[model samples]
Structure formats: C-alpha cells, structure tokens
Target: MKPGEFAGKTAVITGAGRGIGEALAKTLCREGMHVVAGDIKKESVERWKESFPEQEILAVSCDVTKAEDCEALVQTALDRFGQLDYVISNAGILHSGAVDEIDPAVWKQVIEVNLYGTFHMIRAAAPVMKAQRHGVIVSMNSKSGKKGSYKSSAYAASKFGALGLVQSAALELAEYQVRVNAICPGNLMDSPLWTEGENALGIQYARNRGITTEECRAMYDRQVPLGRTCRYEDISNVLLFLLSDDSGYITGQALNVTGGFEMR
Candidate 1:
C-alpha cells in the first residue's frame, strides 16, 4: 500500500492475540489506522496497549462464539473511531480426525468457533457497514474451504460454510456499497497454528497421514506449484489489495493464494 494510504482509517479485527491475526493487527496499526483488536484471552488483548501506545488500538476481550461479544467489539470500534472502514474476521480453530473417531463435541467446537463465530461477526458488522454505505470485510479462509481434507472434516466444513457466508454477505451488502470477500490461503507452515502447541495442525496431519511432521511438511511443500508453503506476507499482500481502491470493483471472491493447490 502507498505510504499513509490507509492512514486515519479505522479497522476491527477478531482473534488479534496471535499468529495471522496479530500480524494483521500490527500491519494495520503500523499503517496509521486505528485498530480495535479483539481476542478471547484478556491478557493477550492487554498486551496491545503496552506494545503500541503510540498507535491507536483498543484491545478488547472478546469471544467470537458469542454474539454479544461480537457486537461489543463493533461498538467499541465505532465508539472510538466514529466510523469503521474495515472488519477482518480472522478468528478460527482447527481439529482433524475421522468422522467415526473424533469426539462429536470436539467436532462441534470447531464449527462453533470457525463457523458460528464468523456469522456473529458479520451479523454485527454488516448493519454498521450498511448504514455507513461503504466498508470492506475480509475473512481469513483456507484452501480447505474449497476442497475437503483427508481427515479434517470439521475444519473444512466450517470454512466451506464461511465461504457461503462471504458470498451471501457480499450479495446482501453490495447494494449498500459494502464489499465482502474471503482470502483462501494455502498454508503458513511456520505459523503457530501449524507449529505450536500439542494440538497444532502439523502434528495432527502427520499423525493422520502416518508420517513424521517434517515429512508431512515436505509433502505439502512439494504439492504447491510454487514449491513452497504460503507465508504471512503473501496473505497480507492479498488482504491489502482487497482493502484498497484497486480492488474496489471486486467483491464476494474467495481469492486463492495457494500456489495453484486449490486450482488443481
């Protein structure tokens, strides 16, 4: 983006505590936009205040699974910035297992967060964007949304539903000058979602495939036509375009940044 192109604009982001969400929040804040960053963890959100006192950021405790919390987040952005120019729905969770083996509750939790959470966010922000008559809404989707993964039924289902939401919301909000879209990233191997914690996607995929983690990573890398995994910068670049005037004519697209994986 041009220097200060987004300056003075305001944005709201969900799941701003870590990984892609945190990176997105930092990017906007650095671009001189007022960002209301919301995370489920109180301590995680609080860090934003201490980290970027010079930037305008309202870090709020939010659980996207709840509509009230979602509404509160949008209201916070309006109360602080007077107008909301962008809303990035980045909050999501993943759990992979066969339909017969995975606990029903575990499968349901993924849907609740990745799917229901997105619905709540859109339901809360759409009205405001409609009222303002101009806004950009981007959802952090994945290639799994387009095709089913071997054992990631829940994750794929949530994302597929999210795509429907993005498209339908685009149609509903387009008349009001609100653009709604989704970015389907291939995979950020280095991201905490894949690498960190005991329940990381990397570990789950490796286990389900009967391969070592490194082997699983290598397999995915080789599958990408780009011969590499997706990166945060790749996603952020697409996101910036979707938020800019250059893409003012684009809406309801689930643009693929998958190195041709999704196309295949």
Candidate 2:
C-alpha cells in the first residue's frame, strides 16, 4: 500500500492479541490507521496496547462468540475514531480430531468462535458500513475451507461456513459499496496458532504420527510447492490490498495464500 493510503481510516480487528491479528494491528497502525483491537484474553490485549503507546489503538476484551461483545467492539471503533472503514474478522480457533473421536463440545466451540464469531462481527458492522455506504470486511479462512484435511474436520467446517458467510454478506452489502472477502492461508508454522502449546498443530501432529515436531514441520513443508510455510506478513499483505482501493472491484471471493498447497 502507499505510505498514507489508509491514513484517517479506522478498523476493528478481532483476535488482535496474537498471531496474524497482532501483525495486522501493527501493520495498519504503521500505515496511519486507527485500530480497535479485540481479543478474548484481556492480558494479551493489554500487552498489545502497551506496545503501541504512540498509536491510536484501543484494546478491548471481547468474546466474539457473543453478539453484545461484537457490538461493543464496533461501537468503540466509532466512538474513538468517528468512522469505521474496515472490519477484519481475524479471530478463530483450531481443532483436530477424527469425527467420531472429537468431543461434541470441542466441535461446538470451534464453530462458535470460527464461524459464529465471524457472523456476529459482520452482523454488527454491516449496518454501520451500510449507513455510511462504504467499507471492507475480510475474514481469515483456511485452505481447508476449500478442501478436506486429514484431521481438521471441525476447523475446516467452521471455515467453510465462514466463506459462505462472506459470499452472502458480499452480495447483500455490495449495493451499499461494502465489499466482503476471505483469505485462506495454508500452514503458518511460526504462528502462535500452530506453536502455542502441546495441542498445537506441530506438536499434536508429531505425537499423533510418532515423530518429532521438527520432522512433522519438515514433512508439511515438503507438501508446499514453495517449500515454505506462510508468514503473518504474507496474510497481512493480502489484507492490506483488500482494505485498499486497489481491490475495490473484488468481492465475495476466497483468495488463497497457500503457496500452491490447494490450487482450487
């Protein structure tokens, strides 16, 4: 994006405490946009605020699964910045298990956060954007949304729902000049989403497959034609385009940043 292309703009981003969400907050702030960063972890959101002492950043404790919290987040953006130009529904959770072995509650939690959360945010932001007659909404989907994964049924199901939500929202909001899109990223090895705990993808996959995490990582890396996993910056860059006027004509599309992992 041009240096000040987003100056004076404001955005509300979910899951801004870590991973791609954190990267998006920092990038947008540096590019001259005010950001309302929301995360379920209050402490993490506080830390994010501390890091941006000089920028216009509002850290909110938000549970996106709750519609009220989603509304509060959008209200805070308008209260602080007076206008909302973008909504980045980056909040999501991952779960991996065989359909029969997975706890029903686990499946529900994944859907609540990954799919319903997107719905709540968009539902709240849509009216505001529609009234203003201009805005952009981008959700963080996954390559699995386009195809099946070995043990990612729940996560993929939620993402597939989210992509559908994006398409439907795009069609409804386009007449008001609001564009909606989803970004499907492949495995991001360095992200907190995969490296956070024993349950994380790398460690979990390693244990399930009887290999070291390093070996698991190497195996997955070999699957990508680019021979590398995605980076937070890579997804954030696509977000920058979708939010900018450069991609004004694009809407209702699920764009892939998967390094040729899933060509569809």
Top model number, TM-score: 2
Model 2's alpha-carbon lDDT is 0.92
* TM-scores of the models, in the order given: 0.95, 0.98
Per-residue lDDT tens digits for candidate 1, residues 1-264, read 466789999999999998899888888887788999999985776765577879768889999999999999999989988999999999999888898999999999999999999999999999999999999999999999999987789999999999999999999999999999999999999999999998888898898789999999999899998999998889888989999888999999999999988872
Best by lDDT: 2
Question: Candidate 2, clashing residue pairs?
Answer: none
Instruction: Name model 2 segments beyond 4 Å from true.
Output: none
List of clashing residue pairs for candidate 1: none
lDDT of each: 0.91, 0.92
